[model samples]
Target: MFNRYEADETYGLHVDNAIRRVTGSSVTVRADLSATLFLSDPEGYDGGELQIEDSFGAQRAGFELPPGVEAVNLKDRPPLPRAVLEPHQSIVFQGMMGEAPRWEDLHWLQRQTELPILVKGIQHPADALRVAEMGLDGVVVSNHGGRGLDCLPSAIEVLPRIRAAVGEDFPLLLDGGIERGTDVYKALALGADAVMVGRPQIWALAVAGALGVAHLLRVLREELEVTMALAGTPTIADITAEALFSGP
Candidate 1:
């Protein structure tokens, strides 16, 4: 969650089907009100609509505050001349999240840094091609895993076509459905720069903490090495789709 964006680098806008303030196909979000603390002076950065007011609280139509309510503490709807809740009490709010971001917002982000910006969840081959054409540095390909109503294909299943569409040079980071070392090898063979392994690590962490994670990584490495050896590909660079081919 922590990032070091230099003077020339800035954040971008987010837009999903629901216009969420999220970064990718999947994001870790907090349901409660969130706060952003600025370490640097406001005068030091590019001035835009960076600081927005945090107007929060429930937004239910025709929901009037009880006659005596000044500030709701939730229980005991008494007539009040004074505040009901302490300044530190927990409260729920479903305030406006604002409009979905426009594609033009990418330029605003690009103006700040020379660092590569990779968009996540570029599932379609055409989308991948379009992203590359738009000068995006790369993309994180994903299936989103939950098998939404459309029954979208996995990243690996579409990865080859995406690679063909974008060419070999553009960076492609495959994510989701990667459970084993052979999965990693297959991703590479099918033209992924790298693969993300979040679930297995989470499982490992839940089972044996940090050392479990280390053990999990070792196991994956051994599996990949064994697969490479059996396929007669001595090095990662030697793996290709042909190596994975057999009659089918």
Candidate 2:
């Protein structure tokens, strides 16, 4: 529920049949593997929707992987196709909702859905306060794993300021650099309601499949338990600044 990524039916909302015209065909974007729904024919219809799983954070328009996207893996998997562009040469993804998420876009989205919406890639305290002003559900503090820009600070480094900016009641979560359970503990102490992790799960999947993932979780749990015991925090609630050896 708290991961950086989210998907809701790939198609979550619906149009009132009263406003729905059979002639008003929805313009759909069928990406290679994923399908993101867009308001396609808003002029012809009264109500429509859109959803971006990882909902923000980019210096440019669109998102894409390095490569191997167009590659075909078969019964006998093939070698990852050779990189056509230089390592830094980015390839644009065509089917993605064009353009990075904008302030106006979030405001417009508010007009469309009553469903809770949270924006990711927010590291600035001002931005976090802006999200609250916009009535967004929450924010995932991230630098998009630091893959987007070299100048962005790690999520943890900026978290305390964001927390202070938003105040305690806001639902603030942190993402990026969550490798160990101690990472999780410190993140909470720093004022994150929760944390999200990515690379480790992928590494587990590569190394030993589902079993590996389960083992990795167990290890993290044990580490967190050890950390809590050593700090004398019996429960997650007891984990506060006192538990952190160094101030956040």
After superposition on all CA atoms, how large is the RMSD of candidate 1?
A: 21.5
For model 2, the superposed segments whose C-alpha errors exceed 4 Å read: 1-98
| lDDT of each residue in 175-221, candidate 1, tens digit only | 98888989999999999999989899999999999999999999999
**Index of the highest-TM-score prediction:** 2
Task: Give a tens-digit lDDT track for model 2, residues 57-107.
Answer: 442556655675543446367534322332233334222323456799998
CA shift at 23, candidate 2, in angstroms?
Answer: 41
Q: Show pairs that collide, candidate 1.
A: 8-112, 8-113, 9-112, 68-79, 68-80
Q: Give the poorly placed runs of model 1, Cα more than 4 Å off.
A: 1-98, 147-150
Question: What is candidate 1's CA lDDT for residue 99?
Answer: 30
The window of 10 residues in a row where model 1 has the poorest summed lDDT is 89-98
TM-score of each: 0.58, 0.59
